[model samples]
Target: MKFLHSADWQLGKPFGRFDPDVRGALTEARFDAIDALGRAAAEHGAQHVIVAGDIFDTEGPEDRTIVQAISRMDRHACSWWLLPGNHDFARNGGLWDRVRQRAGDKIAILSEPEPRELEEQIWLLPAPLIHRHNLEDPTTLFEAMETPGARLRIGIAHGSIRDFGSSGETKNQIAPDRARLSNLDYLALGDWHGTLKVDARTWYSGTPETDRFQRDEPGGALVVEVHPDIAPTVTPIRTGRFQWLNRDWTVNDKAAFDAECDELLAKVDAPNTLLQLSLAGITSLGDRVAMLARLENDLGHRLRHLAVRPDDLVGRPREEDLAALSVEGMLGTAATKLNAKIDAGGPDGVIAKRALERLFVEYSREEQA
Candidate 1:
C-alpha cells in the first residue's frame, strides 16, 4: 500500500508575532500546503493521505477553519485520514463533531481507536487521542488489537516517543519499540514538526508546513509504501510554499561582508524566504552602516521578511566615519559626545553606540539623497 503521510496542519494558527499582512500570508500558506499535498498525492500515486495528528491548532477553531479544511480535502482523489492530536483532542460534540458534519464521505476523522480497513488486506490501527495528555501509551492496545491472521497492519498515532517533545517530561509518550511490539508493518507519528525516522518501520511525518522559526529545516510531507512481511519505503515530498531560514555570519571587512551578502541573496528565493540573520566579529562603523543599509534597502525589500542582529558586529568608529559628520557642526558635536560616552563604557555607552550608528545611517541616507 502506498500513502502520503503528513500532520500538524494547524489550520487556524494566528501567527500573531508577524504583521497583519505577513501573518495572513503565512496562514494562507498553510492552506496552500493542502493543495500542494493533493497534487503530490496524484503525482506520487498515493492511494491515501494519513495525517498522524494535530489537524487544528486549538480545540475551538472557527467554523470557517473546519469548512476550509474539509473543502480542500474533498478536492483530492485520494482519501484523507485525520487524527486528533494534543492540540485538538477528541471531545464529545466538539471540533471533531463539527468537522464530521461538513466533511465529505472521502474524509474520515479517526477519532476512535477502531481498526479501519483501507483495502481488502490493508488495515489501519489508529490510536487517536481522546485526551490532551494520556499517561498511558495510546498504542498500548495495539498488542491485543485484533486483525485477520495474515494482513498488513499500519498504526497511526500522536505524542512523543520517550520525552521526544518536552523539558525532560514524558507527557503522552509512546514506546520506542511500539511497531515491533504491535506486529505492525509501519507506524506513522506526529507532534515533531520536522520529518524524521525512528527505527526501520516507525517515523514521525512532521508538519506539512513549518510554523516556527527554530524547527528542523525543509518542512514537507512523506510518501510511504508498505506491505506485509516487507520493509516499508518512506520518501519525503516538499509541499510547503514558504521557507523559514536562519543564518549566522562572521564579518571582518566590507569585501567579505559584501561577498557573503551576495552569496546569500543568490541562493534564496527572496519572495518565499523569511530570513533571520545574525552577525558577529568586528568591523568599522562605516562598513557597519553600509552593511545595515544594504540589508534594509536591498535584501529587506526583496525577501518576504528579514530580521537582523548586529549586536556582536561591533563597530569601531574610524576617521572617515567621523569625517563624514563634519567635525565643526552640530552633527559633529553630537557625534563627538556620543563617541565619548561610548568610550566611557556603561548603560549610557550602549545607548551612545546605538545613537552613533543611527547617526551614520541617517547621514548616509541623506548623503545618498
Candidate 2:
C-alpha cells in the first residue's frame, strides 16, 4: 500500500514575531504546502494519506482556515486519516468538530484511541490527544491489541521519543521502545518537526512545512510504500514554500558587515524566503545604522521576512565618541551608563540594557526637536 505521511501543518497560526505583511504570507504559505502535499499524493497514486498529528495550530481555527484545509483534503478523493496532536486536541467545540462539519465523508477524523481497518490488509492505529496534555503512554493501548492475521499494522501518534534528546523536558513523551513492542510494520510520529528514523520500523515524518527558525534539522515529510512481507521504503519530500534561515553575523567593520549581508542575501531565494539576521560582535553606531538602512531599503523588497537583532553586539565606547554625540544631560549620561552596564553585565544582562538604551534614544530624539 502506498501512503503519504506528514504532520505539523500549524494552520491559522499568528506569526506575530514577523512583520505584519510577511506574517500573513507565512501563514498563507502553510495552506499552499498542504495543497502541494495533496498534489504529491495524487501523483504518487497513494491509497491513503496519514497525518500523524498537529493538523492545526489551534483547536479552534478560523472558519476560513477550516474551509481551506477541507478543500485541500477534498482535492484527492483518496482516504485521508487525521490524528490530533497537542496543538489541536479533541476538546469541546474544537477543530475536530469543524472538520467533521466540513469534510465528514472525505476524511476520517481519528480523534480517539482506536484502530480502523482501511483495506483488507491495512489497519490504521491512531493515538489522538484527548486533552492538551496526555500523561499516559498512548501507544501502550496498541501494544495490548491482538495482531490481525495477514494484515499490515500501521501505528500513528504525535509525541517525543524517549531516547531522542532532541527536546529537553517537553511534554508528549513517547517511549522509543513502543514501535518494537507494538510490532507494527510502520510507526509514523510527529511533534519533533524534523524527519528522523528512530528505528528501521519507526520514523518521524516531521512537519510538512517549516514554521520556526530552529537550526536543529530541515523540515519535511515522509512517503512510505509498503508491501506485505517486504521492507517498507520511506522517502523524504520537501513541501515548505519558504526557506527559514537563522545565522549570527559578527560585525566588527564595514567590510565584515557587507560580506555577512551578502552571504545572507545569497542564501535567500528572494521573494520566497524568510530570514532572521542576528548581528553579533562590536561595531560603530555609524556602521550599524548604515547596515540597517541597507537591509531595510535594498533587500526589503527582495525578502519576504527580515528582522534586525543587534542584541549580541558588545564593545567599549570611546569617551570622545560620546562627546561628539551633541546630546546633553540625562540622555547622554543614560546612554553611556547603559553601554557600560551592557559590557559589564555580559550577554544575559543585554536585554535589560537594551531597554534602557531605547529610553535613552527616545530622550535624545525628543531633546533634538
Model 1 bad stretches (over 4 Å) = 165-170, 323-326, 329-346, 358-369
Which structure among the candidates has the greatest TM-score? 1
Per residue, candidate 1 scores C-alpha lDDT tens digits across 1-369 of 799999989889999888887898998888888888889999999989999989999999998888888888889899999999988999999989999889888899999898888888788999988888898999998887778864799999998886654431126889989999999999999888888799989998877788877653556998999977889988988888778888899998788889988897798787888888898877888888778879999988998888999898878778888887975489988999998998999999989988988888788788889
lDDT by residue (1-369, candidate 2, tens digit) is 888889888889898887788888888888887777888887888878899888888888889998998887787667789999888887657678878987857699888787888788578888888877678877888976654663699999888786446452127778787867887888898887778898887898877778777742445778898776666899988777777777778888668878877876676577877677787877655455566668899876678877768667643334644664436666567666667666677664576455554553454466569
TM per candidate comes to 0.92, 0.82
Candidate 1 backbone collisions, by pair: none
For candidate 1, the TM-score is: 0.92
lDDT score for candidate 1 against the true structure: 0.86
